[model samples]
Target: KEDYNRNRPHSSLGNITPNEFAMKIAMEKQAA
Candidate 1:
């Protein structure tokens, strides 16, 4: 589960790992 969240790239996330995508969303929310 850790590897999938940190290492695997997701197609729905523009090929970025889930961890990165979540961080991006969190930052966006904070900025808003």
Candidate 2:
């Protein structure tokens, strides 16, 4: 269950993996 939650792509986040989405958001914040 934990693995699935961390590894799955989400439709709400543009179909990217959760980790990828998180990293993307973090990068955006750093850029700002």
Candidate 3:
């Protein structure tokens, strides 16, 4: 389960893992 949640890249999320997507959003918000 840990591997699936953190290691897998989701097609719906532009082929990025959920952790990566969340980090990207966080960085964007900080930049804003």
Candidate 4:
């Protein structure tokens, strides 16, 4: 999880910061 959660480019968020990347996913799920 650490590898995916950090040290990598997040394609879904268009390569945003890792912490931001994870937050975006979380927010999207909560919205759903």
Candidate 5:
């Protein structure tokens, strides 16, 4: 449900939650 989408870690995303992956990507973009 909503909780899973917001907090579950996904294997495809290097075992990170969706929000974490998004933040990681954002930080990488900023660094670049």
Candidate 6:
């Protein structure tokens, strides 16, 4: 369960998952 939350890919964000999506968003914000 913990692994899934930390490493699983989600479908809503182009199949990137929650963790990945958050990181991507953070990076984009930083770039902006």
Mark the 10 consecutive residues where model 6 has the least summed lDDT: 4-13
What lDDT score goes with residue 17 in model 5? 98
- lDDT, candidates in the order shown: 0.90, 0.92, 0.93, 0.79, 0.95, 0.83
Clashes of 5: 0
Model 1: per-residue lDDT, tens digit, 1-32?
Answer: 78866879989899999889999999999999
Q: C-alpha displacement of 24 in model 4, angstroms?
A: 0.1
Q: Considering lDDT, which of the candidate structures 1 and 2 is the better prediction for this target? A: 2
CA deviation > 4 Å runs, candidate 6? 1-6
Residue pairs whose backbone atoms clash in candidate 5: none
- Model with the higher lDDT, candidate 3 or 4: 3
Q: Which is the leading candidate under TM-score? A: 5
Taking all chains together, each candidate's TM-score versus the true structure is 0.73, 0.82, 0.77, 0.52, 0.84, 0.65
What's the CA error at residue 29 for candidate 3, in Å? 0.4
Query: How would you encode candidate 4's per-residue C-alpha lDDT over 1-32 as one tens digit per residue?
Result: 78677867777769776887778889999999
User: Between prediction 3 and prediction 4, which has the larger TM-score?
Assistant: 3
- The prediction achieving the highest lDDT against the true structure is 5
Error of 2 at 15 (Å): 0.3
Cand. 3 TM to true fold: 0.77
What is the Å distance of residue 10 in model 3 from its true position?
0.4
The deviation in Å at residue 5 for candidate 2 is 1.3
Judge candidate 3 at residue 10 and give its lDDT.
92
- lDDT tens string, model 3, 1-32? 99787889999899999999999999999999
Model 6 accuracy (lDDT, Cα):
0.83
Distance (Å) between predicted and true CA of 5, model 6? 5.0
What lDDT is reached at residue 29 by model 6?
100
Clash-forming residue pairs, model 6: 10-17
Count of clashing pairs, candidate 3: 0
CA deviation > 4 Å runs, candidate 4:
1-13
